[model samples]
Target: MSRQFAILGLGYFGSTVARELKRHQNQVLGVDRDETRVDALSDMLDHAVIADLTDENALKELSLEAYDAVVIDVDDDLETSVICTLHVKELGAKEIWAKAHSDAHYKLLKRLGADRVIYPEYDVGVRVAESLNYHAMVDFIRLGERQFIVELVTTQRLVDNCASVANLSIDRDALFLVAIKRGQEVIRNPADDTPLQPDDSLILMGDLQALREIGRQI
Candidate 1:
C-alpha cells in the first residue's frame, strides 16, 4: 500500500529518505529551507517547498494532517526539530520519525512525540566496526539494548548440513537461526530443521556475545 510522507529538511539524510520513500511508491512532500535543495528534489518528490520548518505558524499553514508519516531529519537543529515534531503531532500526524545527534537529542525527540528516533552516525559507525571485526558478519541490527540480529556466511567445511549445525551446541532458549540468505535471495523466518547448505548465510538474533561466539565457530 502507498503512504503519504512528509519530509522536513532537505539535508543529506532527509533527501535520502525522500528519494527512498518515493521509490517505494509513497507520495512524498519535501520541505527545506535551502532553495537549491528544494529545487534539486522537486522533480523527484510529489511536492517540494522551501520553508522554515522551525516556524510553527508557517508549519501550521501546511496540511500536516494529510501526511500519514512525517520524517524530521533536521540534523544539529535540536530546537527546530523538537518544535516541528510537536507541531506535526498537534496537526494530527499519525507517525513522526526524527534524527538525533546525541543522547540528549534522542531524549528530547521522544519527549516531543517522535514515534522513532534515528542516530544515523552512531548506528552506521557501530555496524561498520562490527563488519570490520568479523569477516563472516555481513551486517548487524539491534533488536534490543542487549540483543542483536546478525547475518553471517556459513562455513563450507561442514561434512553434513544437519550434523554440522547440531554439533554447534547452540542454546535454543538463548539463540537460534532466523533465516537463510542463499546467494542474493533471503528465506524468511526459517526453522531450525531447515538444512544449511555450504555458502549459505544465516541470520541469527540473540545476545551480542552469543552471536560473536557462534560466529567464531562458523
Candidate 2:
C-alpha cells in the first residue's frame, strides 16, 4: 500500500525525509521556498514545488488535504512552521508530523495542532548513546515517565527459547517481555513455552532500570 505524503520545507531534514518516503514507494510532494533546493529534489521526490508554507493561500492551493500525512520541517522559521501546522490541521490532513528545534518549539507545534512532534537532534543523540553502550539494544521507545519499550537481542543464557515472562524474573516495579521481533515477523504476547532464538529481538516493556539490568546481565 502506498501512502501519499507532503513535506513542507526542503532543508536537510525535509529533503532527507522526502527522499526516504519516495524510496519507500510513497507519493511525496516536497515544498520549499528556495527554487534551487526544490530543483535539487525534483528527481528525488514524486513532486517538488517552490512555495512558502507560511502563506495560507499558497498552502491551501496545494491541496494538502489530499495527502495522508504532512511533515513540517521548517527550522529556520518557527513562526512559519507553526502557521503551516495550523493550516494543515484546518485542511483536515489525516496526520501531521512536525519537527521542533527546542522544547518551546515542540510545545508550540503540539499546541498548534500537529499530531506528532519530533526533536530529531535530541532523539538521535539519545539513540546513538544507547547504541554505543548496549550494542544489543537496537532501539528504545518511551512508554511513560520511567517506562520504555526496548528492542534487545536475546542471549544464549535465557532459560526458554521463546520470549516470555517465564524465563526472566521481573520485579514488581520492573520489566517484562512484550513480544519477540524475529526478522520481519513479530510474535506478540508469546506463551511461556515459546522458545527464544539468539537472533530474535525481544520487545521488552517496563521499567527502564530493570531492562538495563537485564541487558547488563546478558
Candidate 3:
C-alpha cells in the first residue's frame, strides 16, 4: 500500500530517504531551506519545497497531520532539528522520525515526541564493523538490544568436516536454526540430520554472543 511521507531537509540523508520512498511508490514531500537542494530532487519527489524548518507557521501550511509519517533530518543545526521535531509533533503528525547526531540529541528527540530516533552514522559503523569481524556473515538484523537474526554462507570445508547439522557444535538452546537457503530453494525447519551442502546459506536467530561464536565457525 502507498503511504504519504514528509521529509524535512533535502540534504544527503533526507534526500536519500525521499528518493527511496518515492521509488517504492510512496508519496514523498521534500522540504529544505536550501533552494538548490530542493530543486535537485524536485522532479523525483511528489512535492519539493524550500522553507525554514524553524518556522511553525511554515510547517503548519504543509498540513503535516495528513502525512502518514514525517521525517526530520536537519541534524547539522540543532535548533532547526529540535524545532522541526517539536512543530511536527504539535501539528498532529501521525509518526515522527528524527535523526540525532549524538546521545544527548537522541534523548531530547524522544522527550519531544519523536516516535523513532536514529543515529545513522553510529548504526552504519556498527554493521560495518560486524561484517569485517565475521568472514562468513553475509548480513544481519538486530532484534531489540540483545538478539539478532544473521545469515551465514556455508563453505566447502564446513560441508566436509561437519558433514551434517547434527555434527555442528551449536548451542541448540542458545541459537535457533531458522532455515537453510540453497540458490532459489529454501529449506525451512531443517531437521537435525539434514545433510550439509557447500555454498548453502544458513539463517539463525538468537543471542548475538552465541551467534557471534557460531559465525566464526561458519
Instruction: Judging by lDDT against the true structure, name the best candidate.
Output: 3
- The list of candidate 3 runs beyond 4 A from truth reads none
Query: What does the lDDT come to for candidate 2?
Result: 0.84
The residue-by-residue lDDT of candidate 3 on 1-218, one tens digit each, is 99999999988999999989999999999999899999899889989989999999999999999999999999478888998899899999999999999888999999999999989878888888988998787889888798999999998888888888888878988899999998999999899899989889999999888998887787
Runs with alpha carbons beyond 4 Å of true place in candidate 1: 156-163, 184-198
* Ranking of all candidate structures by their lDDT, best first: 3, 2, 1
The TM-scores of all predictions, comma-separated, are: 0.88, 0.80, 0.92
User: Model 2: per-residue lDDT, tens digit, 56-75?
Assistant: 88888889888898999886
Error at 183, model 1, angstroms: 1.8
Q: Stretches of candidate 2 above 4 Å error? A: 131-135, 154-167, 172-174, 179-200
Between candidates 1 and 2, name the one with more favorable lDDT: 2
Residue 149 shift from truth in candidate 2, angstroms: 1.7
The candidates, ranked best first by TM-score, are: 3, 1, 2
Compute the lDDT of residue 114 as modeled in candidate 3. 100
How badly does each model clash, as a count of residue pairs?
0, 5, 0
By TM-score, how accurate is candidate 1? 0.88
Screening candidate 2 with a backbone cut-off below 3 angstroms (N, C-alpha, C), the clashing residue pairs are: 161-195, 161-196, 162-194, 162-195, 162-196
